[model samples]
Target: MALSLCCAWISILLLLLPSLSHGGKLLVVPMVGSHWLSMQEVVEKLSERGHEVVVLVPEVSWQMETTQAYKVVTHPVSQTLEELDNSFQEYVAVHLTQKPFPLNALAMYNTSVHVFNSFFGQCKDLFRSQETLRFLNQSGFDALLTDPAFMCGTILAHHLSLPFVFFMRGFPCNLHFAAPQCSSPLSYVPRLFSFNSDHMTFFQRVENTLISLLELDYCNGFYGEALKLSSEVLQRDVSLMDLVNSAAIWILRFDFVFEYVRPVMPNMVFVGGINCAKKKPLPKEIAPSLLNCGHAISLHNVCELEGWDFSFLFQISLMLFDRLMESPLNLINKAKNNILNKNIRIKLYLRHSITSGPRRVGAGLRFKRQILAGSTI
Candidate 1:
């Protein structure tokens, strides 16, 4: 069956990954909430394939409405040298560069308020110090694939010369747009000013100009502060914008169901659906949503999907599970059915309903190991 073929490929990919690990540490940083759920899907498969994966994430992520199964390292977010560099334009003005300094300095201070500000200011000094360089060099990570939200991570990646992969949690931000068009406007950015006079309607043009001001101010702040040491130490002007542009990767974490997906680039992939498999199985109320998704959630398709192909399958199935779990009445009846399992044996196959075939095999393997190790027959 197709399920059997998929299983074989998944096993092949997983087996291949350990060889790639090369006896080195595998560190993964997953984003919060549904993002974490996506990471969990991959982690479970990887772990099952015999690779050890340590999840590093913000401490507060677990407390949110995640899938409630994955265990991740909960660390406080840190401000990295790259971020300090973002606002470094101020430092750059006072110290280095001789290109229209005063006007740029004024712009830098104005853009500081509209950013993804956080409590990381406390560790700013440490991260920019030599201590950070030493820490990165000694972390012993062979490979790192993390979210772009953390500047410290990317900077650490750069300092250590370790290969790093970045996973973008939302739509990729273009050169001019900080926030998505439908989402909350980045408050610090004034407006985008990239458009010419005939480009758009008045309101859109105004918004664009405002976004542009924010970006310019952001650039001014960045070139001034973050790279100030460059002219003095390394003899150059490094900007935050430049550093961000250089991040190794940006993996989008959304379903193709969303509107207006951008064209795929070499560094950016449409892995929009990478976390939907039942490597386990649907919860009590998820069957209907699977029904709603029409034909995507098939045991045959799922069992047979292997390697990178499963990423798309997981995305669709995960979305359906999310949609189904939203119904209260369905949840209550699922509970009732479980309680009435004795009377339902003649019809619905309740015991096998929630079971995933591959996981059952995993479970069987574990049991066989235990029995083989037993002292008694």
Candidate 2:
């Protein structure tokens, strides 16, 4: 009878063991705007996988909506949403309107400094909230996830002495590679904004080298205020590299198909197509149009094409399409006439991924091949 009772107790303990342990607790500090959108995907997935997720957001923000997937903690910020929006708009306006290289570069630098200053001000306000800081310190979070572009999360993670992961498309001045000690040779690896392909000419390589050299100064200027604020918060001398170098992992939103080949570290993970993981059925209004169209072209409005005439390009595209069609000459003529007479419906599908130059060109070529093979867009 004693042996049987002991066996029964052991079986009960085994059954309850699984339920006794719980998923890890994660704290996420995401940046504003589109950056938050990408990070939110990961946050929700972690929650679904049984981990406890807590997201920190400013009281006033753009696109940081409350969701059931994770617990959101709002902290007081000094800057208002209107002020943030206006600064961002000013930066975008400068980027889009200024075309001359030297003029545009100077304008971009000035506007970016203004924007960074405003963001740093918000970071300072977060640190001032003792209640929020106390809560975070006592939360007993297993790890931290954040976007380093904003710098606030990284600073907080360091302050709390938590191992953190970085989620981003890329960092300004190649900080992503540099902070992680990843190899990035300038000979073929292009610097950001250099617009150089992997196959570089002699002169292009030289330009790439020069740009790489200038990146240090640019980064310092861009993050000067941020570095100072970080030191003040930590109560010690600190640099951007110090804050980022100790990251446990980096989740980069990059794919080889769209990005040039480059060396990466083991801790750096490339989840390029993570944004496309969630699939939804096409809307009723857009689905039929895609199926019925003979050919479709998507134009993303990244910035204003000041002098380019899109209508003429549309006509040219249609003409090329007509030539590429392997149909009877009579059928081809009839189709061309019908398309022209029907005014050639042009639909613009603006997606975040299409913003990159290589991806945009690759998508256009893929669409062209699809159309030639008698497939709908």
Candidate 3:
């Protein structure tokens, strides 16, 4: 069975290159975090490059609601979301004598993981999943790209029986896994994990390990069990991990570029920057993280509460630049309108009428002069 799966992917990946040579469609599913918006450029660029790409994102097309889908993502996404939110609150607190030191990793990790699991449990049964399924059944996607954050990509590939390519948008906790199961609780415990960073100080590495422990908790509680049910939903005991992990030796792990270009295994290629030809630099909000500071988290001086992820900060920057770019365009349009206004033309005519000294050649002047000359004669 594994060999058959291997053969299937080999055939598809082999086809992926030739199809790109001709023009193929790339169907991508976005994870609902910082990486969500980042994938937009990849989709846009592929579309620009004569390839068609349709992105199926969780929150991009939908509004926030307390429905099934909302509950599903809110927990997992919101836990971290709140910690991030509270950082700003804490920052303000200390600024106004709230607390001497800022909120630390322990609190932040706990907050995020709680939110992360709420939805991680039932993403499939969430809203529009059937619609997504229906669309995928007909979409005829040439390639598959998904973030491992949600194990849905592997699920989709297996059900559709399509060629599979797994993407870990961020760094794996097990930099060089002693075990394929990166989900071990040991991986997440602070100070217990190492992320292949030789340069990291002792304390930083400890922090990385703790973060990994938090991740392990999330997976065991949410992601793993969710995946175990996936086989039931798909009506077969397909080792979802095979597609999630590497089912076969020659299969592709498509996380080409991360913050730090660590020496990874051949099976794990950092093809992240590969989706787009050049690179998309990290946001200014992002700086290097310490400990198992895998590529996923970029921590800068854990200052108390800032209420914004580096991702959201980048979005705001883009929005400000957009508004600024439109200002000159708006001004030029206003100037054009001022020029075109007939009221201005009328005002100019009135000014000319008022400034008219006695006319140089008046209608009555010639007649009056003729009459005067005749009388004199």
Candidate 4:
């Protein structure tokens, strides 16, 4: 009896040992705005799983808030919140108004440069602070989690000599695939901003190859300041690709549904639809109206609707519908007028059939009546 009790106690201790030793301290360096939203979910989950998470943010930031899930450590920065907001607004304005191909691309590139410059200014301040550096050095973090949309986290992870993982949709110029040594054939794998599909024609393939050649130069110019800053911080010559290649793992925020068929590296893990894990209920004011509407159209890009010339879309809808409404033109006019006046920017959903149920038209309206009527919002 005594031997059996001792053996049982030993077995219990062995089982508990693994759980006790599993948790580790993690340092998270996240990007601002929408990027942070998805990354925040990851931080919270890590905390819940018994790991200690420390989120590093700038003194003046857009939406990097303090929370119970992780400890927040803010560093001093040169730029203010107002400057960041203005730069983003300017970018949006240029993106919305510009239409010509190369001209629009040029305008966007210029605005993005200004925005990244502002972010780099803050990064410079982070490295300048001896106090912040000292704290990080003493923290004894096991690993780092960061969004590689910007270089601050990548540089910092290297400075700290910590094993880091990247959590992002992807990097521009197909650097994500290139850094991982993943196979990306130009024949089918389209270059960024090339606007070519996976299945390309003979001429399109030539265009893709040309763009692929330009990508290296484009990335170098785009991240020129970051590369310089990285060299200064690390006291070594480091290219952006070198920094990207150093990541121990890549937590991609997409799955096969969103991405085309391609070769992925062993280190890459896909966790698509992570953003939709937590869904908020519809607003009380709009829920009932949305549920009652039968046929709704969800417009994702409001900028595309700015011109209010939907004659082509109306024609398509007419073909989809079996029978036209009493006044098709009037319905279109009312939708345009309502959208202009109300400035509705929410996602709208459309039912499968026009004859099946009630028809209402407006912007910023969402419907789940057909597909998701039984599910909780």
Residue 152 of model 4, lDDT score:
86
What does candidate 2's lDDT look like per residue over 85-122, in tens digits?
77776766565453565566677788998998987788
lDDT of 4 by residue, 1-377 (tens): 99999999999988878553578999999998888888888899999999999999989987777788889999988887777776766665665553565676677778777778877788889989999999999999999999988788999999999999999988878888889988888898888767779999999999889888988887888888889999998899998778889899999987655466777888999987685465454446545654565544343354556655344333333333322232132233233322321232233233233233445332333222231222211
What RMSD value applies to candidate 4? 10.0
**Can you write out model 1's per-residue Cα lDDT over 89-160, one digit (the tens) per residue?**
333333232235334444433443323233223223434456434644566767666654434444445545
Candidate closer to the true structure by TM-score (higher is better), 2 or 3: 2
lDDT of 1: 0.43
Worst 10 residues of 4 by lDDT: 368-377
Best by lDDT: 4
| lDDT for position 125 in model 4 | 92
Task: Assess every candidate by TM-score.
Answer: 0.43, 0.73, 0.44, 0.76
Better of 1 and 4 by lDDT: 4
List runs of model 1 lying over 4 Å from the truth: 1-24, 30-35, 49-52, 57-115, 122-136, 171-213, 216-237, 256-262, 275-377
Backbone Cα, N, C clashes tallied per candidate: 32, 0, 34, 4
Best by TM-score: 4
Give the per-residue lDDT digits (tens) of candidate 3, residues 309-369: 4434434334433332322221111111112111111001111112324211101001112
Q: Which stretches of candidate 3 lie over 4 Å from their true place?
A: 1-21, 59-109, 119-122, 126-131, 175-218, 236-240, 247-263, 267-377
